[model samples]
Target: MLAAGRGYMEERETGKQEAVASVREIFGLSGPLYLTAVDWENSHHRRSVAASLVQGVYILERDRQQKRQGHQSHASPWWNFFHFQLISPLIDDVDFSIFGAIYEYNSSVFEHNAPKYVIAFRGTLNKPDSRLRDLKLDIQAIRSKLHQSSRFQLAMQAVQDLVAVVGTANIWLAGHSLGSAIALLSGKNMTKLNYPIETYLFNPPFFSLPIECISNPKVKHGIRIARSVVKAGIAVAVKGQHHSSQKDDSFFVLSDWVPYLFVNPADHICSEYIGYFEHRKKMKEVGATKIERLATQNSIGNMIFGVCVRDCEPLHLLPSAYLTINMSQTPDFKRAHGIHQWWDPSFDGQSELHLFR
Candidate 1:
């Protein structure tokens, strides 16, 4: 009888341990290293401030994954760690899943220098359930049809509603990868309406050839100038077709709303932005400002497509941005494109910033 009682107690203890392990795995805490908390007060502009925003977007992914696994937790560990309360989740009508969230700041804990509300969007998740819709949106983004997508329309409406209520002074927009593209488009539209809100974009795709990979500087510069001349020619050819007044107004107006763009040089998906901004500066130095300005506003592919289909603009082109490049050597593309790296402590002093205007 004594031996049987001892065996039963041991089995119960083992079951409890297994249950704990299962929960940890569901919450993405199975690994040895976990996410660290940020110091909200001391978070410098580009360092900790950027990390917090990126982390907020990451938590949206976590929240969805946890619920998908039947954990059904009311609170997210990551959001709680950052002292943010989830106001409401942005759900996909078709999938009936959460893609983004609006978080309200804990004013008691963080008094000043913080956003009153942050709307964060998560990138594509490769899971079986969400893969189809997410990939469809990504393809639409590449084709410049993202604006017509249901998800983007939902996001735009959310931003507009929030701005209407809060007046856009303390509201912020943040996202990662595909989410970043959505945020970028939303910010651009808001700026066009003269409602400029703070935006943080992580690993935003540039949708161009990875020109930064070319080893020879002279070769790269020559190629860029050639492309610019060709694009400028196309712009002039179609100048009569396009509405000059609207195009010029939007181009100059967007310059006032600069979004914070964080990218990794090792990640090809977004590294083209580095070359785009650098080449513009070089053009100015070489006294090719006229050609560069025309090229920047229009793209040959977009122009031809717009003529055939409808009026459309290149999704990746930006009039201005505060671009930050992670110079740290990452092990792989997955890590380089990940949202976690934005919050890594090693990111400090390992980044370069350029104000592209």
Candidate 2:
């Protein structure tokens, strides 16, 4: 198990180093990977729009190809230029895009470390409607074991195949935004399959579902009621499950490998969902359903008093960090949510003071 301090340091370095390589290898994207990761507008609006449209189509086609083949594409999009596969194709008929990056662990050189594998999932690039559809699919899968979508099914196959080939112990899972959620689900599924995995998640959304009602005054009442029900249900469902402790013999034990979660302070996915989940897990152990209810009620009350005052802070005690990505350049709150924001160069590279206990 990785200690909290060491894990945080290792995660930051791994992210910085891998972000450069993963961006270039996974996508045939050029220039800065962070720039393409977000829909940042340049002076030429037409070119940006056209490029985004083209990228959207490209991503969807890749998703389709992986599904049709029942695994990742046989010939990676990088193969013609690079003349090699980053990840080997595992299944003949699985779904979802699961790319493998071959690297040597101990060696600094790409070839020297010989055969270490880092499996990565790409984030969303499609239009909002398509993204939302995928989000719902993932949510349904998580909420119900019987309702496995192509993404869930294929992710399991991919991880299982890789674990068989590489052996389970040292394998790493990485992803951003939507991809982060996929990686998490895949890791959780892998755990149940008796394969422990190390995961690095960037800007993973809380529950990975859109909270449209959170901001809409007309829908606030309904949102609160829905949230209350969800709070109670999660409190009941996840009670007695220790999220950080690895000592459990049960299925949900996170003991096998440490997870490194990176997000901005304002990221709703990490702060809100992660916080809520952590709070509930603690309550479950103590059999404190009343406290859980009070916490949920208090959060709702705070939101009503002044929505902006309610900051969805991530679980400070978890191995989490605030990436100080400058947001002044882009005023859109939506853009601030991207993992790309954390990689910006303007801010000091280090994460804020450790909040985890």
Candidate 3:
């Protein structure tokens, strides 16, 4: 994908240039992809946001810290402090030089191969702990934390920049877990705005995205404007859950991804209720919504989401609503923990995917 050419992106004689081009090429098969990393910008357990211009795809990972877990100076001060950077090894898994360039691989991508000039965007605090992240459903303290969310906003800005830079005619996005949800939001938003940024979402949490916000006609109109080329594009979502998923399946959307992606091994809609239907039912019996909403505006929304957020209105409804999609399931092999990494040696970008939908 990478070649010695002085096109739109500033060309470099070094192999590093080839790598970024390769990433761009792979993701760009769909469009000039941009991946922004963040747990919606809530708390400390955030993974670093690293976006590789892999082929036509822009892979973004977020480095986040654990919620509720207190800190003196910082949680991961000694470490890289970014969950996104920790997954650096994945950079080797893809052929970023596929961007019409003669590509080469090396340590530079592992060390410091990011674009020389990065345009950083600001994060927002939309809601507090409305999206649930735990099984215990213990969000009493979390409610006091999350004040707002800045994940989508920050990602949107980064994506806009990437679009301007590569100016791809197509677009696609893919990610796992929370990253997956973010990708869908960004992709759907861009599409709605008429940006024509097609998307490829892998294992996104249906429970996290704000349906109301995404479906808002205003947001849709915004996306329709930036969209140049027009194709519903491909969509994919991967999912698997444990006993909690009574039906042993997930939901689906018409976007060309897995019908639904599972977050916990237990159930497909774990984040919908407070904790357990019985337990949350009891909480609702009291006054959980009022408390949760109050907490949402308390910690700037960031603090609440970093801890507990499933109690909020739209976030709590994510899993349930997504559970309603018509999905076509694919058989998948169960592997160990690091199986999700991009460079897991045997990681197959095309293989693990279920594109039939």
Candidate 4:
């Protein structure tokens, strides 16, 4: 994995590439780690933010090692080849750094192309006033991560910025909680704008869309494309059970993604409070198709393309120190239920992604 992420950039770009490579090392997380980085704020200048649907991935066993894995591939060629073919281009697409992947054990290596632009976003729910902070975020000490940028915002920014740097561009949206929702939404926005988009939704929340796009073309377009995820059954989504008020937290599904992942129960409201200050009143959301309906639909696309990606419990959520969940029972998987957007092997290997960038 280090070799794949290290020195990935050109002669002059090595510094940035290495920085991304060392993310896990700097953070000191245990087990496999997945992270995203992006540059936003500039995207709206020529393009809207683009979420990196995918990012670097890793797996940890026993010793709980957080790094070092290139040696494992020596045992298998397919895994080696998978590593070379898939991972070599992670800067541009998915990287084969993790185990159990077709590319994880690839053999051949290709000449590198242009250096991939990195991005970062701020997904932590940080607010000045204690009253303004989301309880979930505060509990996670996300408020303390002042230096950490929002992966969701950064990924969208990266999508928009990469266009200026990369001749061709694609949006890869992946993340946990808010980051995941932002990535999915950002991809939808790109779809509407008619940009070259290949979205990678990871643990994306079946969140309620903001009311700002009620009449916007981008909003409408994103909704339509998002519906496609539903049709494909790739999205473990949730719809607002109560339509009366613009702000409702009721869920419509109990099965599918959220429950399967077994993320902290309080993850459900992480958005409600996180999006605070911006939409304190609990804004209205618009979706082409209800999240609940997508749950029941048995489409060939979902069954065939969609992989049941989650384990009964996420490796990160197993301990309370890392994540303390406040569970609330509800039918709506998206609302007040950390059920819809989740990571795991059930939906394929997207479980480890942190789309905040």
Candidate 5:
């Protein structure tokens, strides 16, 4: 009986390996693959630019995975496809793994309507080697400690250095999932410093309940009002004590620098953003702007920490964004939250945009 059980377990493991191999081959994981075939020089709009930036991020993932499999140098076709060259890879010192990279467009080949440089960060990978550190950062993000992480600090410094060298007008930032959070935070920090850079965030996590999933509009509205009132109370309580003029100025300045936010309704991790922006519009319509504005800037967690320890802002709160929602149907959560969907030809046309302030 023991011998038979061992044989069955071994067979199952082998089957899983074969299945994984098949999937990888189909997706061209063994080699470089382009997600889109758009003409780079002829087309230079939001969709095209976003595709290039997201692809740069995808290459970062491929580069690291290839290295893990003992490949010394893995040439990425996606970077070449967009006529971009890998400049410097952002490394996580703790794990010595590549979490992000900077790509420079080939100026001689394409000069019109192209970003001079793009810095992209990859999301979490479920692989055995890097999962520990990646998840550690994810947890830190939830606790608002992501800014203090070595990886985020490295990303922020890279952005600052690049901006100093090339100026903020020509640089772009892109990331997916966890990477999106890093890019978003980095962009926010730079914006606060009076250097706003163009940013693309794909499926960035919103560390709140999926209130957007509520089917009834009235119930959802009621819940939002209740939550806002509670947060507003906290904001008022701490208003006189911890609120500083500099902090208010920072938030006001950030309101004018809007980043491009790409989200899918099926992706619960990011879908709350849809409701978040929509709720603000509704608040304006109903004359709750004063309460909403106060609530928007303060959260329970940040208020408590600000009074007790130090001032901290909610990571997910943003003053403005060019919110683009993927309206196309997705098969599952993974597909919905995937970075690949951002570049899909069908998806390019299926997205709807709303400018939120």
Candidate 6:
């Protein structure tokens, strides 16, 4: 009995260690703005601030690696076709640490292709302060405060500046976890404003519509009307602009750029039931869906009491090409969720890179 007890304790310790390591890797990749002291009060203008933050000491290694990847002979064909440049910076506020990266590509080899940009967002940190910070963000997320979130706002500013300089329909976006949520919301909002860009959502959270949207019909209706108005305005403003040729897929042709969604079926945050029907269909197109309805049902029940109260169906979130990573041997919960698991270097070989961009 004593031996068994010792073994159990050891197992628990190992699990805790793994959890810590997983979270640490995410913060490390996000760089040191949240890890170190940040001068929030006297921060420079958004453009200069973003540029300076990308030069942070901690992020240098990743920048170096990205550059090295660009020079690799066996790099993706996509890389060979265009010249890629990157800028990453952590934008910190009182509530959240938002990590943003921009990749600029110029089709030097191909004329009339025009320059393009890819914006990436890093998920939440696992630090002590981040835990406290998440308390407020959790509430805000439940409220679906996309426009109100400082992190979301900062991301928009970066995109807006880039759009002005490089122009539209040439931008792509990517993010994981909380960052994914922000990216989806931002992409949706931007599309309504006629600045449609392709996006990649990596393990997006389950609560796409927010609990508040479910509870308050008026708020939901108001948001819908507002978006419709924005879309109408955009259509009028860009009426004479040249439209790009649609991609091959019927589902992808709905938007300007095809959004690619990378997820693990076992991921608690992004299982089969989490997103809309169109999203599930896209996931099916890429790979098999993992059924963990009991876990998902329980998770949803816990997150929003509003779901229980409301009889009507909640609104669907962004639609994209869903790519699921298969891990039959590992526990569904263990293999799924968490920012680091999906993109960590340790699992690079395991990642399904061929299917989606």
TM-score, candidate number 2: 0.48
Query: Per-residue lDDT for 235-320 in model 5, tens only?
Result: 78886765567445556668878888888888888989888888888888999988888777665776766633233456788888
All candidates: TM-score: 0.83, 0.48, 0.28, 0.28, 0.84, 0.49
Candidate 6's residue-wise lDDT over 1-357, tens digit each? Answer: 001001111111254333211222223332223212223232121111222222221122222322323433121221222244555554557643435667666544542323366676655433343445544554555545545767778888887787777766677666656666667766765665667766666666655433222346566445433433443444333323523233432223234434545555555456532333333334345453322111111223322333321122211233333344434343435335543343332342223222122
Of the two candidates 1 and 5, the one with more favorable TM-score, higher being better, is 5
Top model by lDDT, which number?
Answer: 5
Would you list the clashing residue pairs of candidate 5? Answer: none
lDDT of 1 by residue, 18-63 (tens): 3222322222442112334444454333344444444444445444
Task: Write the residue-wise lDDT of candidate 2 on 1-357 in tens digits.
Answer: 001111111111254332112231234343123332222233122122222222222333344433434344322332222222343432213333332223213333354212255555545433222345454544453333312456546656777877888786656666555555666667765665677676666655553234432566447434544665665555343443523332442222433434556554345545454444444444555676564543442233223333221122111112223322232454444544554344333433323322322
In model 6, where is the ten-residue run with the lowest total lDDT?
1-10
Candidate 1: list runs displaced more than 4 Å.
1-75, 246-248, 307-311, 348-357
Worst 10 residues of 4 by lDDT: 311-320
**After superposition, candidate 3 runs with Cα above 4 Å error:** 1-148, 170-172, 198-202, 208-357
* Candidate 5 residue runs with Cα over 4 Å from true position: 1-45, 48-63, 66-75, 305-311, 348-357
Which candidate number would show the highest TM-score if scored against the true structure?
Answer: 5
lDDT score of model 5?
Answer: 0.70
- Whole-model lDDT, candidate 1? 0.69
Best-to-worst lDDT order: 5, 1, 6, 2, 4, 3
Judge candidate 2 at residue 180 and give its lDDT. Answer: 58
Give the higher-lDDT candidate: 2 or 3.
Answer: 2
The predicted structure with the larger lDDT, 1 or 3, is 1
List model 3 lDDT by residue over 1-357, tens digit each: 001011212212365422222221222232211222223232111111222222111112111111212332121221122222211212211221111111112223332322222222111111122122211112321232111334344456556666666543422343333334444445544543445443332223323222123346566333332120111110010111112232322221223322222222222323222222222233345555333222221222322233322223232222221221112231321211111222222222222222211
lDDT of 4 by residue, 1-357 (tens): 001111211122254432122222221231112322112332211111111112222221100122234653112221121232333221112221121111211224431321233222212222122112223322322222211224223445556655555533422233334333444344443543445343332222322333322457466445545544554344333212212331221111111112112232323333222221122111113342344233222232323443221211111111001111223343343333321222211221111211110
